[model samples]
Target: MKKILMQLKDYYGEYLLLIALAIVIGLIVGVVDAYFGMILLKITEIRSLSPFLWIPFLPLVGLFIVFMYQKYGKTSSQGMGLIFEVGQGENKVIPFRLIPFIIGGTWLTHLFGGSAGREGVAVQIGATVAHTLGNKLNLMKFQTLLIVIGMAAGFAGLFQTPIAATFFALEVMIAGKFIYPALIPALVASFVASTTSHFLGLEKFQVYLAEPFDFSLFHFLLLAIVGIIFGVVGSLFAKSLSILKSKMAMWFKNPYRRVFIIACGLSVLLLLLYQGRYAGLGTNLITASFSGQHIYSYDFILKLIFTVCTLAVGFQGGEVTPLFSIGATLGVVLANILHLPVTLFAALGYAAVFGSATNTLLAPILIGCEVFGFEHFPSFFIVCAFAYFFNFNQSIYGKQQILK
Candidate 1:
């Protein structure tokens, strides 16, 4: 035991510097995320009259995105692929040039009413920071680990889910195998980042639920059914996005050109459908879930469609946030049909669907515990596990190869 303790101590110190660096990187990422969100909200106000007014010219926004990418962002096109490359021992550092491209591109995409999420942009920024720092400092393998930890910190800071964020950084690449060694550093960075962001007045997503209801056999059975449905939906969303992206890529030799045309076309369609409700980050859908308001039974379906189109067309953003909105809405509708509490179902749906889509079991379970409290752990674990299995190893990141 003493030998084991001593070895652990040595290993812990090895990562101490990396953890500290991740915390600092996380702080910057948090600020950027918050500022970006504020800017998007302001833009939404400017275009608030109606989506209809913007529909006719919406494709122009996509053209502008393409123009910017062609002019300045050719190298950063890989996004998450770049991160995975770096993780797997590639020397390709995300150049500082990408920071501006992502920031500008993402801002433009959202300002013009593209349906997307912000976390992916933030993660790339965070990883870029870590990459730059590692290169400048001449750090070795351990520094690469720090970069991954920085990713978790950025995610935790943005979403305010420290535990989930820690696991997410480790879980995102593949299924089954947990990166146990990185857990401590990831957790430390995530918690510090989340705390710092909270101190800076970043609000976490809040959901109101009544006391733990009795979990009868019937409730478990219903929850399992919800898990299966969510799994199917999640799988479909991922597959659709992959297929669309591939087809678009095949049709256009240049990715940038393809993205521009597709984005513009989708924007126009969105404008025609123009409820002014499904645009931007779709946070309103999340709010509606908590409030027990009636949502379009097909709200999840529409969001899935729009999000896939937006992302497939090269709008940089994370898929998780939109997944949350879609899952919560789906849950609410499902709950109503099953005569269950909307709040409960919505919460379960949110985590389980995400878990299934990402092929992450424990991350979503921890997310549920962190966001909705530990009392829901049993249901969360069961539902998320079922969802994970039902999804059959599908994921939004199609390149990810699951070892376990």
Candidate 2:
């Protein structure tokens, strides 16, 4: 205990710095997330007011995203690939020029009814801030750790799951090895960021559930089965997106043409499925997941199709949020089939499938506990472990390396 206390005292200054940085990053991320959300909401409203006018122009939005990438997104290197590059010994600092491109491209994607998540945009912004700070301060390896911490901070600030965000930053890069030394900094940053976001009145995602029922043997078996199904669904989702991306690359020699093709395809599909549902980030579906209401048995399949196409088409966003929407809805459907509690199964599905898809175990379990409460911790851990192993090396971020 004395040794531990001394170590804590020694690292107190570093912890304080991380906390301060996290607060600033979190506030920035929170404002960006909220602002982007509001902007998307306005664009959505505009499309609603005149679908004929907006729908016809949707393909142009895709073209604009392609144009932005051709012009200014060269430094991004595509999606989270750039993050891995920085983490794995590349001095390829994220330029501030890429920030506007990411924010603008993502906003336009959603504005024109592209299906994607906001977390990707927020994360890139957070990392950019850290990278810029590191460059300006000329900090060494220790400062690079701040880049990772900033990722956790941004994610926590946006999602309001600080603990999960901490682990996510640690877990996202490699499997089987936790970066134990970074834990203190990551956690401190996450807490500061989450606190800052809350102070700024950004709301956390909410779920309604009855008390967790007793963990019966039968229920556990049933959940395990549901987890297995989720594993398959999640794996398929990841594989399909990868395949589509590859195929698109092969089909169009021009990157812009590939994006245009995807946009046009999505427009046609959206028109056919014109409920004005399953468009954009699918936040409505995530909200409905908790209630286990209004979700058809096939909702997951539809979401899977739309998300795969949207992401495969080269739009900017993270897969985790859409995965959450897919998992929760599927869990509800599975619960109904197995005669289990809808809310309980939905929560399990949300975490486990996300864990499976992302090749993350603890982060998703923590996410479950953070979002649903500690009472579900044991169940969440069990299900997520099952799903994670069952999926075995599959990942939504294809560039992630499996260490272990």
Candidate 3:
């Protein structure tokens, strides 16, 4: 390694330092993600043991969560918005405290049966850790790059999809721009984080799916149609989230009252409807969509409404998993109507809807190939491309900047 570096006069120890930092950051975030995922799953399992016992207290939990944030959260409560502000250079500092605040808040949300996702927490965890490291090490010039690196590691650590994570972090800050220099560090961090989390016993969700029929012009056109449907649904989910967040804040005014009142209602609705079926990541819907476990036509719509409501009312979590659930369930219903194989269409939805909702093109396509199988790459590409085109540039991240 030293010999190679010596051969290039222009390049010296900077590359080595960057690589070392990426590896260190990845290792640290990977350990954090592994514990975060495990604790969350354990709490969710415990809650499922007696949802009636646990779920009724959602309003109280909501109050506690709000109080915790109000007391110790400070600017951390801005959540992903703070990360974005730093990424876009509008703000510079991401406090050291965001990591615990997000993780603890999300764990409590899941434990109390709030309908939410985990990816947002994962991304924020990564960004905060990496950004803190950069700040301490005086890597001010690469501050934005560190945020991207941390985001990739956090996502990869949680989902075990390094390729998709790298692209997601790279493309997420801007609609049509890429941070070219962060590519190597980001990739290194992602793979290391993914490997570390897997080694620590966090499981990655995967399914094997293939093209239902021979590829033909008819199939291609049909895929385009399906993609549009998923796109519209994804757009609706993103738009509704923004609207609900704004409207709820306007109406309630007080954070404590808002969370408590809404959570009381959500607890009853979540309990009454299928006994906590739409709560905590919507993995039930996703599993049912794939496993043929009696998914109703309204499953997607209800999950969408429940998740948007949960987040809008101050619950903590991410949106990507619920988006995945929505896509998968919607795909199941649509496939039945279109007379196509449910597995194939559901897989398409799992990826395409996420892409559409996040306004990310490559990440979803790559995630499809990674989580499902690369053999379905063409199908994923076709569906994800169409979905991206029809997304109308809506994103669950309120602070995302569209280059176009």
RMSD of each candidate relative to the true structure: 2.6, 2.9, 2.3
Q: For residue 309, what is the lDDT in candidate 2? A: 87
lDDT per residue for candidate 3 within 52-164, as digits (tens), equals: 99899999999998999998889999999999999889899889888888998899999999988899999999999888888889987788889999999999999999999
Model 1: number of clashes? 1
lDDT score, candidate 2, position 63? 76
lDDT of 2 by residue, 1-404 (tens): 99999899868866677566666666666566556545655766666555555555557787777777877678774657776667656656677776788777777776677777777776777777777776776654554576677678778877889999999888887777676666877787677767777776667885646766677898678667777787878888878888888887888878777778777878777666754466777677877877545887777888888888888877776677778889989888887887778888888898888888888889989999898887788788778877887885788777677886
Q: Where is the poorest 10-residue window by lDDT in model 3?
A: 7-16
Stretches of model 1 off by over 4 angstroms after superposition = 1-12, 45-56, 254-257
Q: Rate the local accuracy (lDDT) of all candidates.
A: 0.77, 0.75, 0.92
Name model 2 segments beyond 4 Å from true. 1-16, 41-53
Q: Distance from true position, residue 35, model 2, in Å?
A: 2.8
Taking all chains together, the TM-score of candidate 2 against the true structure is 0.91
What does the lDDT come to for candidate 2?
0.75
Candidate 1: tens digits of C-alpha lDDT, residues 1-404: 99999998987777786677676776776676666655755666665566666544556767776777767777787777777677656655777777778778777776677888877776777677777777777775665576677678777877789889988888776566766666777788788778877777767885656756678898788778888998888888778888988887889888667766776667666766645567777777888888856688988999888988888877766788888889999998998898887888899989988887777888888888888888888888878878888987888876566885
Q: Compare candidates 1 and 3 on TM-score and give the better one.
A: 3
The C-alpha local distance difference test score for the whole of candidate 3 amounts to 0.92
Lowest lDDT 10-mer window, candidate 2?
48-57
